[model samples]
Target chain A: EAGVAQSPRYKIIEKRQSVAFWCNPISGHATLYWYQQILGQGPKLLIQFQNNGVVDDSQLPKDRFSAERLKGVDSTLKIQPAKLEDSAVYLCASTLRSGRVYNEQFFGPGTRLTVL
Target chain B: AQSVTQLDSQVPVFEEAPVELRCNYSSSVSVYLFWYVQYPNQGLQLLLKYLSGSTLVESINGFEAEFNKSQTSFHLRKPSVHISDTAEYFCAVSTANAGGTSYGKLTFGQGTILTVHP
Candidate 1:
């Protein structure tokens, strides 16, 4: 089976510029997530969606970051006015379950965003 | 809330030698623990997981981890290392909320880089 897919494996942008990342989850997957991984650090959860509705986004920076999964199959994460601190790899993951279960998540290659 | 801690930032060991990577977590309620391996320019893949029952879990690639509820630790181990096993290993934890809303969100550690020398 095919795993999660992401676009623009690498990206570069100037500070204060806007950038967007795309994610297409595994087939039949019901849950999708977005994470940020800084160099030398593990990925941190940014937002989560169950189908077309958001499940959690408490850790996301509301002022600069936003994400949406309109049709529940694909999702997009956007960062406006990017800062140097936002330079990191953005990973997308998906799972088959929407409720409590021991489901494993499948991750994508990630989009490495470098803000100069 | 949950958090994970990886004691070692990097570990170097010769091939065919036994190795251990330490991990500790903090959470008030019960949690599901997992270990993920990330190769160069690749996404993280699940190595193993510990949910309930057995404290020990093994991955298909000869990696194993033991979950210790008393100490709140889950350490990954291998009887003998291989060069191909060199990668960044991450420990993560997630708790199921009382509302049965398991968003499957994970809290990951800083990660440990394992370098295997032939």
Candidate 2:
């Protein structure tokens, strides 16, 4: 089975510029997530989508970041007016369901964003 | 709120040597714990998890972690490390009562970089 797929394995943008990353989750997966991993830190959940509907986005920076899963299959995360602090890898992951049961999540290689 | 902390930011060990990576968590309620490994330029992969039963959990890769409720710690250990074991490891936690909607949403600690030198 194919794993989660993400585009532009690496990206470079200047501060104040906008950047966008794309993700296509595993087939038949019902839950999708976006996470930001800064250097030396574990991934921080930015947002979660349950079949196109947002489940959680409390940690997302609404002022600068936005994400959407149009068909609940592929997803896109955008950052406008990027700052140096936003330089980090953006990972996308998926799971089979949106239930309480323990399920393994498959992750993409992630899009490494470097804001200069 | 739940939070996890990995005490060691980096650990260097010779191949075939025993190693331990310590983790601690703070939560007012019961939580499910997990360990994830990430090789270079790769995404995080589940190593093992601790839910309700069995304080000790082992991964297929020969890595094991013991959930110590009394000490509020879950430390990953391996009897003999391999060069392949070199990677970044993360400890995570999720509230048991988070329910279906928020069930798998995890709070992760700063990662520990394990370097196994051959």
**Residue B34 alpha-carbon offset, candidate 2, angstroms:** 1.2
lDDT per residue for candidate 2 within A1-116, as digits (tens), equals: 99899999999999999999999999999899999999878889999898999989999999999999989899999999899999999999898753565466678999999999
TM-score of 2: 0.94
Instruction: Name the lDDT value of residue B96 in candidate 1.
Output: 73
TM-score of 1: 0.96
Residue A22 lDDT in candidate 2: 98
Q: Which portions of model 2 show Cα errors greater than 4 Å?
A: B98-102
lDDT of each: 0.92, 0.89
lDDT of 2 by residue, B4-112 (tens): 9899999999999999999999954577888999988668899999876899999998999998988889999999999999999999887666342336788899999
Q: Lowest lDDT 10-mer window, candidate 2 chain A?
A: A96-105
Provide the RMSD of all predictions against the true structure, rounded to 1 decimal. Answer: 1.4, 1.7
Docking class of predicted structure 1: medium
